[model samples]
Target: MSTYVIGDIQGCRDALLRLLERCRFDPAADRLICAGDLVARGPDSLGTLRFVHGLGTAATAVLGNHDLHLLALAQGFGRARDGLDTVVAADDAETLLEWLSTRPLALHHAATDTLIVHAGVAPQWTVAQTLALAGEAQAVFADRERRRAFLPRMYGDAPARWRDDLTGDDRLRCIVNVLTRARYCSAQGDFEFAEKGSPGAQAGDLMPWFEVPERRSAGTRIVFGHWSTLGRIHWPQANVWGLDTGCVWGGALSALRLEDLHLLEVPCAG
Candidate 1:
């Protein structure tokens, strides 16, 4: 009953299948946790969604920035690119999207004591706080009425720093950004969304969210995707594991076993 945490995937269903086979995944025994961006930019977004959705109770996924983009496009808020159009036009699009919307932005796996998110947690937030904040945003995405209003207006980078006093859409957006789009941020929790390069590539005081001094979420292991440019799965001394090995960009589709940190990858080269 091993649990494997897979990376972005980004709609590469064939690569995902091969990677799962490499791990010898069994729906009857093993559990799969997807680090998000399950669709977009690959050859089979619709098929990938259906495959994961079909996994039923065996699979769990959090929403990535790309996942939210697809959600917004389905509701006339944004335009599609890559393979998302197929998902939007599918007969079962509504059902698939509904399941996606129900997914939380932050999830805690009790067996591994690992927090799984698309990106990283806010430097100032404790593990419990991260899950609580994620619940707030989850409520909005879960309610159809609020979903209609929020999806269209969800894109933004303002109020880059998080404050406990934040309210309304601003609060929801902040939580979403931290759990989904975050990469580089100041120690004070000010996100630097533009820096997607590896650690040394950034200028100024911004550092990788997990590397921030005295990060409240430290000590507990964090597994995340969304930063393929990061160049490796394990950092020298960090407790976080970066699993996005650029699967959609012609790199390997990667996965890590939670119990032993056993790693494996299957090259797809896009």
Candidate 2:
């Protein structure tokens, strides 16, 4: 049984299929771990959602920014942005929303020491702490009334630094951003959301989340997507693999074999 970790799909169903074919994936014997961004930007968002959701126990996905955006839009918290073209219209958005809400913000495979999250974690957090925090935020979204109230308060930058004293929505927002949209952070562990380009393009003071020294979870292997411009980075010391190859921007879709750390790439459909 092989387990493959795929990069951001971004709604490119054809590329996903081709990548699976290249890997000779058999659902009966293989498992897939998706880095999320399963919808938006590219064509066939609905198809991508259905295909991945159909995999059931054979596939696991961490929630990405786009996936959360879909949830927020479906729940009437926000509208779709210009570049993000969602395939789900008003009529069929409910099904997609329900499926997306069930996805976790992070996944940990204890046996393999593979920690999967859509983006990076706070520098101060250990893997166990991160998972506990994620569970707290996920609980809000899992509850019907709580989710509605939480979505509005979800968009903010306050509680910039991690504090155990931070309670209520402020704490939840910080957790959400770190697990979803975070790219770079200040040395103090505050998120810097303004920069979306490659790691070095940002100001010298800002460092990619993974670069923060003394990271508590550095011992475990982390697989993440979101910074497509970073392409693929294999860091030996950190046991980190960045798999975002920018399929929505005409780059290839990538997958990493978890058992052997082998890579497989499939060119995106124009």
Candidate 3:
């Protein structure tokens, strides 16, 4: 059975369906790992969430920034953005949001030696450390009382550089930023939130997280999606694959086969 890693669906259910059909995905055998941003800003957030949620064990997802935003909205911490109201108003909204909250910030596919995250890992973190750190944030979501407090504190970009000594919300927020919102980072590994452009678009000394020299996680293959502006990059030299192709922005929905690096895509209806 093949394992397919899809980029941001962003509520474009039709495009996702077409892309899956093209891949000939079988729920019984094939596995689907989504790089995240499953719902938001497109035609059908509710339908998209239902389809992925229906996949059950056959599918797994990493939590993207949009996903977190949705979670926060669900908990009454943030304002509902356009296109997201459908999901919030759905009958199964609680169920769907709960499933999303349970998703990890990092997912490791052992057979492929690929670490899947919604955005990028901290340059200083190794594959093992990335997962461990992600777990810390995941634990917060799992705790009822903690989740209520945590979701509201989830919206900042303070403490741009990660430090071992950081405690409480600061630490978790940094981890979430690196895993979901990061694109470019300073040479010394500080997150550069404002530079969301493609590789060359950033200013001096700033580079894509995966391209950071001597990044500890560089040894393992990484599949990430947050930067749709850097669309469909397969930099084997860096062992990084960027699958987001701006499908929510009227581009194509894209996916990569874990075993062979073959690409499958379908133009978005949006």
Best by lDDT: 1
Off by over 4 Å in 1: none
1 or 2, greater by TM-score: 1
The Cα local distance difference test for each model comes to 0.91, 0.84, 0.90
lDDT of 3: 0.90
| Per-candidate RMSD, Å | 1.0, 1.8, 1.1
- Tens-digit lDDT track of model 3 for 1-270: 999999999988899999999999999999999998998898888899999999999998999999888888878888889588778888998899889989999999999899999999888899999999999999898676888899999888988998989999999999999999999898899988988887887898998888888999988999999898994479877899999999989888999999988999999972
Which clashing pairs does model 1 show? none
Residue 181, candidate 1: Cα error in Å is 0.6
- Rank candidates by TM-score, best first: 1, 3, 2
Write the number of the candidate with greater lDDT, choosing between 1 and 2: 1
The alpha-carbon deviation from the true structure for residue 237 of candidate 1, after best TM-score superposition, in angstroms, is 2.1
Kindly list the per-residue Cα lDDT of model 2 for residues 147-243, writing each as its tens digit.
Answer: 8888877887777678888888888988998988888888889888878887678986888888888988898899999888774568777678889
Residue 254, candidate 2: C-alpha displacement in angstroms? 0.7
Q: Model 1 over residues 104-216: C-alpha lDDT tens digits?
A: 89889898899999998998899999999999998898888999899867888977988999998888888898889999998788998889998898989989998998988
Order of the predicted models by lDDT, top scorer first? 1, 3, 2
TM-score of 2: 0.94
